[model samples]
Target: MTHAPSPASSDRFKSFSEFYPYYIHEHSNQICRRIHIVGSALVLVILATAIITRNAWWLLAMPVVGYGFAWVGHFVFEKNRPATFKYPLWSLMGDWRMFFETVSGKRRF
Candidate 1:
């Protein structure tokens, strides 16, 4: 990812909203998007389980919730690096956004 990816160019991202298109472009595969969705769902489940069980250990699952499935997708399916390394917070937002987009039919698979 040392090479500049045309779609994720920093030139166009003056703000978070401006960066959204670039973020969307980074996720170009359906499997990658699905993996992200699963990871996010697992995150939510972990959060709920943590609150219900009152276990601090469940909070430790964030990395797995966030990175596990995404890493697998990157290595097995996309065969590319995750944008999370470049933008962690926005990468998260992008994942949820992509998930909702897929569910809402705003994104084509």
Candidate 2:
């Protein structure tokens, strides 16, 4: 079987525009994509709850909730390391883009 190149390989994505397609490729597994969507949604809900209730501690849970689901999806379902480790900003942008895409029915859930 042919193997996909590692993200660190000569796949020089010099811009978020270029990196997004690669980000989507990393999350091709259905379950992994769903987990990411749920995590992103939960992060928004948790952040909104924190603001409405004025509970700053709830703010701390955003990353925990977000990364918890995402990491499980990556390790257990996707069987790959998350690009977040190597491309934090781009990965975060990709997460939201994917979330919106899924929600808008442009991409499947």
Candidate 3:
């Protein structure tokens, strides 16, 4: 089996684009992507509900609904550092892109 490449350096990322390959490298596991997909969808739903009902609670649920599943996937399946720890914004974008790639047959896993 091909092994996932270890991070070359822990040095700070200069930009989000620079961090994306490392982010994708960390998400080498199929289970991780699946969890991200579910979590992101839940986040969207929660945001939509918050918009509709104007409930502050739905906004508060973003982390629970988003990171909960994602963390589980990271800790249990991938056993790797999530890009969110460093590149929060890009990691969010990466999560959605990776989810779509997996769903649309662009990514094998």
Candidate 4:
């Protein structure tokens, strides 16, 4: 049986700029956005810890902590599937971009 294309599949983004708007839309919920920002910040902390202490094991927790918070925001608050599943690279980029934007006062937290 032929299945219809999913929304994400149907909307193919040609560039990071194009994908970013959709990414922002997906995180419209205030609480969800805050959670994502927190997750991204924690990822940075984990990376710093891994580098400063020269412990590779700390690296593993990065994804767990980042994705864990993001997933909870998406599933619980947004009630939507994460854009990460369909747009892995762009989603990751979006995460960092959003985090920075929020922290820099360009976007709301």
Best by TM-score: 2
lDDT by residue (24-79, candidate 1, tens digit) is 66666678778877887788889999999999899999787679998887778877
Global lDDT of each candidate: 0.76, 0.90, 0.81, 0.90
TM-score of each: 0.78, 0.90, 0.78, 0.89
Poorly placed runs, candidate 1 (over 4 Å) = 1-12
Cα-based RMSD of the predictions, in order?
Answer: 3.8, 2.1, 2.6, 5.2
Residue range 1-109, candidate 2, lDDT tens digits: 6344344456566788878878888897999999999999999999999999999999999999999999999999999999999899999999999999999999999
Candidate 4 TM-score, C-alpha based: 0.89
Stretches off by above 4 angstroms in model 2 are 1-11
State the displacement of the C-alpha of residue 38, model 3, in Å, after optimal TM-score superposition: 0.4
User: What lDDT score is found at residue 99 in candidate 1?
Assistant: 76
What TM-score, to 2 decimals, does candidate 1 have? 0.78
- Candidate 1 has an lDDT of 0.76
Clashing pairs in 4: none
Question: Once superposed on the true structure, which residue ranges of model 3 sit more than 4 Å away at CA?
Answer: 1-10, 103-105
